[model samples]
Target: MSRWPNLKQLHYLVALAECENFNRAAKACFVSQSTLSTGIQNLEELLGVQLIERDNKSFIMTPIGLEVVQRARQLLSETKDLLEMTASRGGSLSGPLRLGCIPTIAPFLLSPLVTLCGETYPDLDLLLREDTSDNLLKLLEAGELDLLLLALPYDLGSFHSRVVGQDPFRLVLHEKLIDSYEANPARYAGLPDHSLFLLEREHCLTDHALSACQLADQAKINPFAATSLYTLVQMVSHQQGATFLPEMALRAGILERTELVAVAPQGQMPHRDIGLVWRPSSCRVEAFAGLGRLVTSCLR
Candidate 1:
């Protein structure tokens, strides 16, 4: 059986499963499409099983292929941990580190942190991928990322983390809405169930903001969705409707050069804690711990 499948073949298979396209998977694996295809074919021949079903328009994984991909991920992750453990004996942390952060946090916080990582560890080739939390966590589980920056108190099970920072939610209101809410700030909490504009679904910020204001049960989140924070800010500036903004976005001048302003919601303000998380099984625990502390410093 050709000594079973090799790590390189396993990597290609996993990449294809995740990307679902040859061109994209090849690009991610840093190989030509033909090379990735050949690797996968060799693995299939060795295993005597068809892993992928090729079609004229789409690629799909067989059921067994799905199961094998999961195991391949674990094998690759363990191998990486073993290598990192060996490297740790020499007191070196330099390597290609893949990191992922959500869209909301990426624009407001990642730029300075990227520079800091470069300056602090010149040998570390840090790769950053901005995506939704779901995608980032999926990548993390697949061992595609060494660590991730994400907001907390959601359902990230079993993954260990270091709380790096917190972002408070600001009650962003239009100039005209100020008089409506300033006289009775509590009234803003009762905003018409349908008046609040929000980011599309699966954005943790949307959920966090809604929960922070205690609106999860009743607030009528508008069907008019925003693709980015700037869109929400501009909507508010034009007096479209009111919504919440994170402290980091405010600090980044999201409302700058506009009439839009933020007021702290009355009572205990709503906030989300940001953290750097990694799989506990990772061999880079020491490096991740050091990186976590460094991340907090850069964030500030």
Candidate 2:
């Protein structure tokens, strides 16, 4: 018979590998530094390999140790999925669901989604995290988030996704900026790249809008980037410049009682497909699909 290191020890090693500091890893594992040290010792004794190179100044995982850490992460993620699957059974939308959403969509989507879950899936505890899509996707890959609510045409690695809604883009400007944005094609063409603003970098919305407008060479992006659509709306109010906004935000009273005017793009509308995404290996794929349907149904 051969002895094996426990899952908890693997967890400790993963934490150490990520943090690269014994003290920080111990804190993350919620154990004493000496306890974490002993766990690693046990693991090395069992595996007959020095997983980490120890030093007073720094710690480095060996090449094989790095591979083990990667596998450990995958193992922990699968274990979590199994536990969540077991909990999801025998209940109608019961148990916790950690969902991540991009900042642009959070304000418009989260409130109603929360209410809908409360009304329909009373047993479900929906935990929400608002962040950039890149950040959210990282969390999703790490198994920190079960699903993501965001706009698509994004690279989601191996995750599977379902379209829940579409948000068309429109050019938003102050009523005073242009006389009338009617059927005049010149007005659209004469749009100054310098007068245009965006929602800052790393926001997929900004990228989508830029691509749709063919404004790659337009260098007039605002020096100070707007953090939220509301901020952009305020800037438009002050006659700072015209910007692009999604149809959902505009429909949600974003332009209400404000002087900003939202007009559909001159020709074919530039729209983003909103989606719900999760790992295909997740046991809750069907469950998440149903949840996705539930979410989009409310949008109708």
Per-candidate total of colliding backbone pairs = 1, 0
lDDT of 1 at 117: 77
For candidate 1, write residues 92-126 as lDDT tens digits: 55877788998889998888787887888888778
Clashes of 2: 0
Between which residue pairs do clashes occur in model 1? 193-220
Model 2, global lDDT? 0.82
Off by over 4 Å in 2: 90-92, 212-224
Give the per-residue lDDT of model 2 (tens digit) for 1-300. 278668899999999987878999999999999999999988988999999988878878899899888888888888888888888862347789999999888998789888988888888899999999998987788778999998888988889999987788888987766654453465554555567778888888998887765555466566667888898888777754688898779878998888878776643767888899887768887678768877787566
**Residue 6's lDDT in candidate 2:** 85
Residue 265, candidate 2: C-alpha displacement in angstroms: 1.3
Best by TM-score: 2
